[model samples]
Target: MHVPHHPAFPKAPRLPAASLPLALAIPLLLTACGQKPGEAGHGMMMPPTEVSIVTVTPKEVPIEFEYVGQIAGSREVEVRSRVSGLIEKRLFTEGNRIKAGQALYQIDPAPFAAQLAAAEADEAMAKARLAQAERDLTRLKPLIEAKATSQKEADDATSAVDIAKAALKAAEARRTAAKLDMDHAVVTAPMDGVIGKTLKEQGSLVSAQGDSLLATMAQTNPAHVQFGVAEAEQGRVQQELASGELKLADKGFNVKVLLSNGSVYRETGHLDFSDYKADPATGTYAARASLANPDGKLAPGQFVRVLLMGASRPAALVVPQRSVLEGPTGKYVYVVGKGKDGNPAAEPRPVVVGDWVRLDGEVKNGWVIKQGLKAGDQVIVDGVARIFMPGTPVKPVAAGAQSAPPAPAAKS
Candidate 1:
């Protein structure tokens, strides 16, 4: 067959099947060679990442121990009836402040009054009988002296007078007891405090024997906060104090409370009591702090967060909490160090932490470094997320400093 070819057209060359893969890879290799040095996916070398750092230095850092506490009244008393009677009137309102000796409830006084009247009548009859006996004894004594009556008769009269006197004394004692019962018909508060809801209402029967609890009262002016210190934590604290690593305030711990809403309480307290023995179930020692709560802001049974201050760690290294990272092994932090080429690099350092503290000028709390970090170590505080691997080059910047823009991309 006869075919004509155009002058402007050109034929393509064919490649062997074995060489096809090599021909495809050659272009990719050439493209890879054209990439800039130190670029990602081309070489191990990478540009330095900018990060904010904090230079750790040993200093006296204040230590605060926090615990969950419950508010309580300094004195709690139960208002009870001293006499058995029906509650006629409730003198005080429920959930109100009351003064010492204030009338809480009025029992039915009619029964007590009747008993008192009967005792008085008995006493009157005994007094009349004693008068009559004494008159007879006087007459018998004169007759015995004049020999008109026998001496034995006079002796009998004397014995009768003595019996009447004894009866009169017994009646007076009964009268006094009846009067006391009458006075006790009015139930009074034992101390100045805030009263709770009355357990016994009007027309409720109360007795002095057992069922006499009318209401409860609590003294809230000086509120007490009760908390527990774990046995392990207590032991560690003692060891630190003994080793001179921690020092306590001369006057003891100053306590402050945080409300549930994250607000600080106005009044501060002092540690007043600590139990000698630990609780078996919780493995903690009970402790208490006293504070003035004149406004009654702290109510009984309310929960609060207690901060124990006035203790400090001397010559301790600290780092921001956010800077610390958790790994498969344990907690660690990134520090600025010299790389193989003498440039700054991020180095992972394992750390053992102690108590937590809130330092000045820091928004978040910090951890006290017990080991693995020392003075003059520059820890990466901010831009921690930028670090992808250990020993990667990093540009350390002072915390809170603004970094200059990248020279407008070098005007490329």
Candidate 2:
């Protein structure tokens, strides 16, 4: 009896041996399998994680391509001297508005006037010589016909008359040259616009392109705005130009200047020209627009932002950027799918992206799957990182989605 009892019972005491291991293992197993109140063994256990999210929405934002640019007016011209002379007097006010052909500077005309007087005196002397020669020839011709004068005498008189005529022609040419030189003494405005600072004042000798720029005039009546566009976008712009949809080409985009104080200008501009070739350095084609600047609101060398309308793509699929993941392959996003039980499940969707519109990316070829999502579907916009893992459970909350009771449907 002792031997039999000892064989089974001698291994360990009932509670002591088993209790130690049980106490140690029980807690660990419980902790490893522990979950929510009723989620044990249900695979609902989770680890803490962080997430980012974005929502899909449509907004009427301008299709804007932004670039840093300098403020430039339509008119810019450099005034230069047409002839070399001294700046005897500054007739126009510095930085004042001047019209074309308006007298701006006066050069001393004394030298030119003296040249003209000398030409006139030469002309009178030549005329007097011609008169004397004509009388000699007339008398010689009659005497020669009567044999009172020799043939040689009449021929000599004829030659003298020809010389006097030649002298008269030379004097007339000098007079015309002198008049042209006199006109150069007065510098006039080549274009009607505002004149810049006086580079040379009274008594300053300003030779052709010397250290002097008397003044500069820029025609501001209709000003210009120069800009560029990418070659890829040129086709769309050209199409808009041909169609009545845009009235003007890509440059024909309705341009409105926003001043420093955020005030809108009253005038509008039109596309004036487009370059035939693209710039090799930038690969953008040049374009220019003309705007009426009657009030001189637009100034040269100022910085401004341009808003342009591009080709519109209707029926475009879009998704918030936060939903997209940059995997080893490319950009992708998760879509919420419903299981047979209608419980939400997540599935990774690959998408081809296009121009970003605010926080959204234009999705193409992604519309093939119709059931999971739609254009206006409310996707996660915040806390996406917390739920971004494949098949990860999420406590979804919209950016502005507030907790509300589910609405009850009316009885049909």
Candidate 3:
């Protein structure tokens, strides 16, 4: 074959076998590089991304705060022996509900009984001596008045009577103490509660001075939930309340509990107490809620999640938490607005968020927008990943709606 070549175009050198494959691939690679994989050809533009959006509207939204809490009894008491003695028997079953004044342990009463008997005998002897002193004084009074006995003798008899009276009082006091000790030998529950295991076993010697703890009991009815609020969080809430951004219920917060199994407690509670001083250990203010636990479902020392309700944000703007993105400047959200060409576009809008809130009838949480957003602004809730850059044109679709087809590709 005859080929003509001009001086301006040089003849190509022959490639080796290995280099020939690469040489042949150069043209195909150049053709592939000229057009994007998904594009029909060069200069064809990609369709606008489809995104789900929520319209911003000012409405009263209920706000809830959650904290890690623990279940506790309204009253916890340590069962101890009031008198020193050996534990004769365990009267109450371990881990059982007990009533106030119910006998829990029977301490050895033999020694107490013996002491009481001795006191009674001493009291009886004192009574006899007192009677004799009174009789002698009575006899001396008449004798002295009739001049049958000396005045000194009558005075001595009266002194003896006074001494006897003092002795009697001392004996009576001892006897009463002995009787009380005898009664205390039987240890009883101080309040109605669920009793824990006995600390002192049978035949264990317990004393009032030390080692007196026999068991522990806690009142389960009207169960109390103890939780802490961080000092920073408290301050933030106060500021919000002061600015009229948050409104609390007139009564107080209505509390609900989340069990470990992820179920809500049947009974609701109310805020009973909140400490003014911060806890030294936790740097949080202590708060408590009281709930009716008639069925004894709540146990002491159980961990739970506390939900504090009865607060709401009035006429506030909110968006899904996922919609808020953190950029180099601050937190922002993509808002669907009209571009210069009158097409829908995603624009980055900086926002100041106050608190995380769960909307009514919604499971997921949302951010309460404090600033930089107004009512009727369309905020993109989903498909934000598709927005590669600010001011990217988008197809706005209502949340939970069928997505519209992508705009037809622009003709080259």
Candidate 4:
């Protein structure tokens, strides 16, 4: 048989059976031991994850205490009828601002007027009697000196004159009282303020001692915010003040009022009043702040939030709230630290948190770390959830990037 050798088909050299198996196993061994060109030892190593971090810097932060408050008039006055009469007319409009001594209601003056006229008539009659008695005494004095009248008659005449004088004085006193009743028939505002709805309407019978309620007026220009603080907290504040740890401005404790609509009031207020003792039932101390409310924007009974300032936390360690995590045991945070190999790793750190600090009036950004954290520690703020386990390698980047710098520790 003639065998043709082609360029594409190369002839294989024949080998012994045992040696052939070894030759075939050589390629298998090389394929099993060799690594791909792009691959490194073992396998490709993943790069550290990029994360946002906030550096913990201890600084002086203002300690702000917020309490729910109720708005009220600085001065509240209850309008009442001073004399009994029929309400003739409502002099002031409801919900209108009124001035002190402004007429609020007109009561019927017919009865009071009649009483004054009767008193005047009595006074007139008493004066006529007094004049007659005086003329009699004048006649008696001359008669007694002339011996035409008995001494007892002169004495009786003098006594009658004195009695007449006393009666006239009593009549005058009654007239004055009647005049006062007439004046009091008209109810007036006690202080300048907005008047509430009329309690006694027209044609209703009102009296000074009976059902005298007419209306209510409140001075709103300088509004008051009433709030209560836990007695324990107040005691702590007082202790701090005594220790000279907290200092107040010349005007005293400054207060900020936050409206229910989440807007801050323009004018600040001052703490003017505080109850001497804590309420036994509530365990709180009552307090009040006076704020300027010329525009009448703050209404009585309006709910608000009052923030007390002027105290500070010295060297407070604060971090962004986003860096905190809730675990099975308690709250924890990831701190950027060097791992075993000197690579940056996320280390789980337990921390005790304090009150929240609002960076802007609208949103809360950072919170106080009372324990387990110190100054100059890099805390992972963003990309915390990306880390599945502690000691995971990470690349730290500053938070807020170019848009905003790290949130500063708030003073108040």
Model 4 CA lDDT for position 59: 77
- Candidate 2's clash total is 10
What TM-score does each of the candidates earn?
0.78, 0.60, 0.77, 0.79
Per-model lDDT:
0.89, 0.63, 0.88, 0.85
Write model 1 residue lDDT over 125-175, tens digit each, in one string. Answer: 999999999999987776788899887898889989999999999999999
What would the per-residue lDDT of candidate 2 be over residues 1-412, giving only the tens digit for each residue? 2322321112323468757887677557766765333344643444322233334544333243443334464565666665567778888887677888888888888887888899889999999999999999987776788899777888899999999999999998998888877887888888788888888877887676565466677776776666788888887657844663323334335665556665555787655677999999998888776778888777666556554444343334455555555655555566554544465545455556654554335322122121334565545445654453444454444555555555787799
Error of 4 at 256 (Å): 1.9
Model 4 ranges with Cα > 4 A deviation: 1-44, 131-161, 235-251, 359-362, 398-412
Task: Report the number of backbone clashes for model 4.
Answer: 0
TM for candidate 2 is: 0.60
Candidate 1 runs further than 4 Å off: 1-47, 122-169, 361-364, 402-412
Better of 1 and 3 by lDDT: 1
Please, what are the lDDT tens digits per residue for candidate 3 over residues 135-186?
9888787788899988788889999999999999999999999999999998
> On residues 66-109, what C-alpha lDDT tens digit does candidate 4 reach at each position?
99999999989889888988999998889999988888888999
Worst 10-residue stretch by lDDT in candidate 4? 1-10
Better of 1 and 2 by lDDT: 1
The alpha-carbon lDDT assigned to residue 180 of candidate 1 equals: 95
- Ranking of models by lDDT: 1, 3, 4, 2
The C-alpha stretches of model 2 lying farther than 4 A from their native spots are 1-67, 71-77, 82-84, 138-152, 208-212, 230-264, 278-284, 314-353, 356-412
